[model samples]
Target: MTIIIMLVAALLPAVLLWLYVWKKDPQKEPTSWLVKATLLGVALCIPVAILEMGIETVLFGVDGGPTNLADTTIMAFFVAAIPEESFKLLALWLILRKNPFFDEHFDGIVYAVCIGLGFAAMENVLYVFNDEEWVTVAIGRALLAVPGHYAFAILMGFYFSIYRFVDKSPKIAVCILLVPVLAHGIYDSLAMSSIVDPSIGGISVLVLIYFCVKMHKVARKKLLALKEVDKCDNESSFT
Candidate 1:
């Protein structure tokens, strides 16, 4: 029963968010491609885990302490954010670089979000099941962490679409990879601060919530703007 609940809690948010993003696309991506991208995301976790472990060993010497601000920031940026987003970007490149269905701008969001949620799903499960307070952890993550991943992916996809379809510049490609890593790093840094100082941590959590909400709105606006561009292109082609 606990396992059942854990699976549901871990997976339900990702599934719901996936459908929501999929529906937002004016031209729906192929189901197979989305599924494949998601699975590749899960597969990429293995390498990410290995990299994270190696990084932690090198940086911390050992685990299991209340992290200081400097340690937390370093862990967040270099240990967590850089490696995770870099690999996700690589997965997106590998899966969709030459795919036939990646014609529209919004396809970037769809594919990137699929990969993000796939990573989130596997990640959520591990965190939830390993903790003693699984329910509390699961609920908190559902609200903040999972949606946070979605926002990061949307940002990545937004820049990636511009890079791929509009400008095709090397700089934009760099933005596609770096922007999300910065965002994810900040988010994790704030969340981890609570361990060292609860008062600061409390303030950071509120700020993080606001940041996530703002990012969500920005991502939605970008998606709508891209859809409008697609509509104009389609209408022009018809005439």
Candidate 2:
């Protein structure tokens, strides 16, 4: 009963987001590949969790950790952002490595969003399913965390497309991994700091809202920009 509802709540955002990204692609990739990429994302969560635990052990020695802004930032970046985004990037590469459908710029973002939402869906289940404030947590994550992952994926895929078909330099290649980590890290750090200092919770929440809004706006523009580029290429090819 409760568990069923929780599962639905956790997954609803991912489903909506999946459709959103899928519809935005004018020339959709094969559904089979997207589903495979998404399942890889779900499977990658296991490795990502293990890697975060290992990093946490090395950083704080299996005990109390990240009591302040600086340490929290470290945990956010190393423990959370770096591990998760790096694995997703690796997964993206593996999915597209020999993919014949990797023909356009926007395909990158579409596939990346599928993988990201898969990861987010599993993660949302973990966070909201076990909590006592299940409804609140579910709603908050649907609004924030799920979208944050979507935005981060856009950043990764935006830069990935550039690296793959445009620049391919050391710089743009690095952005494929770097931009998401920075965005994810900053988001986590801002959100997590409140746990250490209740007094600053309000300020942190406000900042987090601004950050999420700003990040989504940037990611949205990038997604649309790539979509337009793909459309232009298609039009030019037909002429």
Candidate 3:
């Protein structure tokens, strides 16, 4: 049917992105913990999604409530932004909080990115398979929403790395979660309000891409530094 075709089309982008990220990082083999983290993120999101829908339905009266600004704000802030970020952070924590591979600042970014991508992949499949207009929805999500999620997670990772390397403070992690929640909420509000112009959206995506690339460099640098330090330590011990 036409619906099936659309669904498949929609899944293509997500699949492609997943494959690309996986292939590009073959040095990083996935662990059982990574699978668990992905599952945790997905699981935690369910109740949060229910809460979002419930609040929206109550406020908007079941017709999308014409953007239902108040409800949307509630959904964005409390439901979508907060819960989602918390879950993603949980995913990161569950995997990396005390793991051996988490020896450098960059490891936070790597693990967090994996969690984000896993969540996005599953979520994308659901979207694409759930509707007849899946192709269009998929394109929109892939082009905008999915990348935004990844970027937000990357920010969390970046902060997590900083704190892990220096302070080891829980507050930094809390702030990491809040900052992304706020950004995600604001983005949802603007996106729903039609206030974000196409140019702005395009630029926002570009900016996110730039951030990812910059963070990649930061992660690589830290990793290399750690390797050098380890090498020196090994030599000194032998000498």
Candidate 4:
């Protein structure tokens, strides 16, 4: 009974976060794509999570602590960073990129964030059920992991928008996702590491805030450029 109560407490915050983000679309809301993307993100996380566990088993031993510096770097880079970023990218490509519904730069953020928040929601449920100290896990994920996922998605979508307009540089957008992945890995490493002081957690949170602001600026700039192009097109048509 006690364990069940703990799981409920942990799961509620994640569920609420998912619902809030899922409902946040203001215009031309994408209900079907959002559902599909979210489900796909959650599904991909399962295999990636399993692979991460296996890698940790061999590299960090069953206890999951690093055996050496190289192992530590690989664990952080591959298991934590690459898998998370790639899964979100896969969700975006699968749900939004090829769809006609993805008409604007803002849609990138919308669809990508929904998928990320979905992944976080499911990941949180798994942690909540498994962890004995479910309350702290729930609070930490609400305060940190969920926001981190949103922030990363925003970055992914932001660069993708840039790639769309800057004709010769499409592939660069994929590299841009690395920034968020690195930041995410750093945050995870800091929290997991015994070497660092707890106060530095603020730095990780600040990274998310920084990227959010940066992406907002980029989106605004892109929208303005698009508006200018549309105005030119309108004038040309009239002439």
**TM-score against native, each model:** 0.96, 0.98, 0.68, 0.73
Ranking by lDDT: 2, 1, 4, 3
Please write out the lDDT profile of model 3 over residues 1-239, one tens digit for every residue: 87676656655554565455444442454566555655665565566567667766775567755434565566567656776777788778878866876765545665676677666766777787887777677888877677666666666776777787767688886766876777678666555543324445565556555654554454445545544544665579799
For model 4, what is the C-alpha lDDT against the true structure? 0.66
Best by TM-score: 2
lDDT of 4 by residue, 1-239 (tens): 98677656655654565565445433445678777877887787788898788867876678766644345456777777787888778778778657887765556666776777777778878887888777788787777677667666666766665566454364676555776677667656544443233454576456545654564465445434544554665579799
Q: Give Cα distance to truth, residue 129, candidate 2, Å.
A: 2.0
- Residue pairs whose backbone atoms clash in candidate 4: none
Local distance difference test, candidate 2? 0.93
Give stretches of model 4 more than 4 Å off: 1-24, 62-64, 67-74, 165-171, 195-239
TM-score (C-alpha, index-matched) for candidate 1: 0.96
lDDT of candidate 1 over 155-238, digit per residue (tens): 898888888889988899889988899889998988888878777877888988888888788878887888888899889999
Which residue ranges in model 2 land beyond 4 Å of their true spot?
none
Candidate 3 colliding pairs, count: 0
lDDT of 3: 0.64
How many collisions per candidate? 0, 0, 0, 0
Local accuracy of candidate 2 as per-residue lDDT tens digits, 77-186: 99999999999999999999999999999989988998999999999989987799999999999989999999999999999999888898999988999999999999
